[model samples]
Target: MAVRRALALSAVDRYAAMMISLAVFAATGRILGPAEVGMAVLGLTAYALIEVIRDVPTAYLVQQPETSAPAVRSAFTVMASISVLAALMLFLAAPGLAHVIGNDDMYPFFRIIAVALLLGPFERPLVALMRRDLAFDKVALVNIASGGCNAIVVVGLALAGFEEVSFAWALLAGNLAAVAVAWALSPYRRLLGIAISEWRKVLLIGGSSGLWGLIWRYTDSLPQIAFGALSQPAAAGTYSRAQTIVELPGKLLFVVVSQVALPALAAQRRDGRELKGAVLDSLAVISALQWPAFLLVACLAHPLILLLLGPRWLDVVPLVQVLAIARLFAPLELMVYPLLLAARQTGRLLLSAAIPACVYTPVIFVLASYGGFATACAYLVLIPVNTLVGYLMIRRELGVRATEVLGALSPSVLVTAGSAIGPLAILAAHGFRFDLPIGTACAVTVTAAIGWAAAIVASGHRLSPELRHIALLAWRWASPRLRVGS
Candidate 1:
């Protein structure tokens, strides 16, 4: 029941969070324009770069069955210490960074962002506390409230004539709201509890975990920095929006699922069979959603761009399509990431993350610098390649064979592949132009969906036992109500 509740709440939270954020971006992006939004992206990029510090403690607490007060306090202290140090480093270096980027506007923007970090570290343990106990209800409330805070602050400030710094100020306001709400919900107290042994444990555990988190963020953030420096801020804004559009759905789902997944997987860590089963099952579920949704978005990027971002932002359409296609391979990483962390294989996690940083970074940087966002998006082949490497490592370390892994994913892969044929044919028939009229786009999409649903039924994959049971349960409950109403 806890697992069921967590899943339900996570779905709700993702929907709520994604909608609110989209609304926020639509309002703010239209008003502020891309250059100012680009500046905001740069400032926020600092947050990701510093996330290595907070990840250690959060991962530590989540993997524990129960955290002692002293352990919690110790984790909080270390996180706070590093967060402050990172903030100070950014604060002092902001001016120099702006100078290097040749943008006087970025100096104060980065400084304001630095101030938000001081208040954010205190919220980590509070978050870990709620998550460890599977209290997703509280988690959802806090997320909704904090996201509301960010939207209100950004929109209100932008309407009041603030431009570049509106997003920076929102960060400060949002972080403050999150910290305050977390404190209200948490039973943990602020303490200066310093224990050498505890610090040693955090270092030992966090050594690889922290590095793994940092590498992932660095990979995600470096392109923004490059665009900010090499391309126009407007271009950076376009790329940033593209990145956000492709990532938004996955991020929303992953945030909730990964939180629940870590603790759940950790609980099963002692049983190798159960842990392996958990990982494969998760991959299947994620593949069932991720493949079709991302691929459909790729196919339908035109109408999606028109409806969501409007005419002036149509430049993002191609980037969005490419990115959505590239993201098709993300389910493997998403499933494996939390499982590896739960299994205490942070060493392998670090190596997998490092592979991309070392091999793909230079390639992506060149692409972003010379070829632009579309070219960079095309390089997402690295994701699948890196996942392949991780897969072999998992087989070696966890003794999970390739056959077992492929069995879990192949149904969705083949089914989704079969489903894509109609869209591809329709797209080809239309000469592959994405900027179709709304009426035509609607017709194409509806026809494609209908055809896919029909194919799924015809193939009998739609009647898989799990889905069949769900259908039976739904009908059993609803048929009685229908009879009574008749």
Candidate 2:
């Protein structure tokens, strides 16, 4: 499949999943208090750390030059063993973990979430196989089905007053749905068997990735865990929600791009194509979209919280604004990981992850004791430092200079400035207050969108031509319909 088509499918899938998740989150936020939400976050964070191991097998399979039946089966065997063992360990540890978090009531939440870990062995490797063939349409189908089921289950249970454990049950249901859909659609549906002959190869490639995954997961999870342990009852949940909101753009853009990037870049390398141009183009496109989106989120933080999580989440507004700004340099960090993975530079990838983990984890933990607000402020410093380390690594590995990277990103700066004008104007007019009337908020959004479009054309960012093509296609489609109606 063409890369663009793959990206489009991934984007559609991610956007749909995001909407479903947001709906569930908003519903639950309204139905459950911050303490309940915090407990759920703690449980999910623990699950996510364990889930990092599951990605190792998937990464190994996806990056292979070619796959045989034995290799696929071996990957599956590894994943299944890891999943079952991890699930059992987590189940046994739940009580102790809950006690450590100062909430013995969280034992059930952790145990329920552990049950979802078992589904990983069944679902992830199949998805990886599909992604290997660039069969993103099939991947999209699986994701949409899973997400729909998850939304239904979560909303239903939350409305029934199951509280935070509703999320745990919904997670298990979603993974089961994904497993069923993937099993039905996977080309490797009949490739089921166990073999360890290639286990060494899988482990060699995946070991570093797994380690990096562990560090990366902990880096993200530690702050929240710390909040759960050290801060007020609501701090963890509030921070988690703020992160959810701030990460929407990254999840939408970076996740879609990265899903397509690693396999695509690996293919390019196998074909003896130079990766420099592709890397630069990706940076340009990512910055152009990501920067403007984060800026808009910062500008509209209060109204967004009002609209999405209700007034009950008002404390999250400033955290969202701060984190959104901190995330401006995120494109740099996002570009590095897949590039390293594609280049088979797992060592460098491990180092890149380690640098940030070593630097920021302890500091964030300390700040967590103070409050979520302090923790958010720490990211303002942490992200830039992380980005610099990543940029240096990219430079060292790819031999791409600062000038080249800056040149690619320059147009995006203009585009961001242009996109920010309307929102900033509105904010300035309102003395930078985020609490605006619905109609005014709508006006700000529309004008900011208009400004973004104008800037895209004016600055000639890489995405401009694609935007024009989409516009032309839309016009062509609408013209005949309008004439027929008239």
Candidate 3:
């Protein structure tokens, strides 16, 4: 029951964050030009890379509750040390990176972002601790408050014509707000003192974890960096917009899974059978939703992009289509990475990421350099291969058969895939010639509704027994508000 509450709270938090982000993206794009938006992406990418680098120690700390305080102190110390070092390096390298990306104007923006990057680590580990304790309602409030403050700051700055700097300031404000909120709410009482014994233990776990972060971040960021370097700012803007299309749903799933799965996996790590069942259940549920969502996004990308992002972003439609389809498998793939780590299979997780990093880096770079944005987008074909490797590694770690994983996912895939084709066929015949907004809304609404119904039916039209009980309780609680038509 506590686990269920954590999940519910996490989902609600994600939904709130998603709503804020949608508004932020739309407002920022409308107010700032494509070049400014491109610079904002650069700032975010740098921040994202640093965040990944710092997360290893924080994650190590959060994974073990008994040692959480000392581990968190050591993690904070490590983040401080690395933050100073990274700021120095970024200050030196910002000019070079700006030059490489063909945007000299971004150098100052990158430098300003360095300040916020240093501040982020302070709050990040605290939030992780809250999550470790299954305190997601508090976590949700913190995210909403921080993100809301950021939206207001960015919008105000944009109105004052701060342009690119507006986004940077917004980041600084959010990081600062999160630090305050998380510090106030955290249960682990610790000062900023580091112990050598604690450091050694954290380093042992986090150092290896650090390599994985480096590889994963470098791999993930390469696509964006490649786009920024090889393509124009406007083109980068379009590609970035394409990413948001794929990322919205991805972020929603990721938020809930990360919030719920990590603690759940840690609690059950000693029980292999239980762990296997949990993994299978999560795979079944997440894949059912993810596959259909991504497939429908791919099918509706053209009208959706134009409708959401305005005509300037129309060029992103094809790119969004490619990425959306590619990411259909991402939810399942992503689910395993956290479970693998929680089950002490970090080495396997690193190896899985390394395979793609080795194989696809040159491919993405080569294609982006010569082939252009669409060609760069074409690199999504590697996702299935990546998922297969991850699944194999996870199976090996759990001593489970690959067939078990595949078997659970087969029904959802078939049902949703079949249902999604209907709207795609409809869109094809009618085209986008009608009222643009109405047509796109109709396409997304009808397709998603049909796909969901099909999925429910194909899942035997029966909720999990646990789910059914929860639904009944909810209806009973709301019975006073219910009205039956005569």
lDDT of candidate model 1 versus the reference: 0.75
The candidate 1 region of ten consecutive residues with least summed lDDT is 188-197
Highest TM-score model number:
2
Clashes of 3: 0
* Model 3 error, position 146 (Å): 2.4
lDDT of 3 by residue, 302-373 (tens): 667656767776767777777877887564676767887787777787888899888778777777665335
Measured against the true structure, the TM-scores of the candidates, in listed sequence, are 0.88, 0.91, 0.87
Per residue, candidate 2 scores C-alpha lDDT tens digits across 1-486 of 497798778778878878888888888888888888888888888888888876688878988878689888888888888888988988999989888777887788888888888888777888988888888899999999999998899888988988888889999899999999999999786775688878888788788888998998888876687877773558989999999999888887767566677767889978988888888998998898889999888888888988888898999999998999999967687788888878878778888999998999789878888888899999989998998889877786677888999999999999989988998888889887889888878888888899989999998788999999999999999999999999
lDDT of 1 by residue, 130-187 (tens): 8778777887787888899999999999999888788888888988888888878877
Query: What's each prediction's clash count?
Result: 0, 0, 0
RMSD for each of the candidates = 3.2, 2.6, 3.4
Ranking by TM-score: 2, 1, 3
lDDT of each: 0.75, 0.85, 0.74
Error of 3 at 164 (Å): 2.2
Task: Give stretches of model 2 more than 4 Å off.
Answer: 1-8, 63-69, 133-135, 185-194, 231-233, 259-274, 484-486
Question: 117 in model 2: Cα distance from truth in Å?
Answer: 2.0
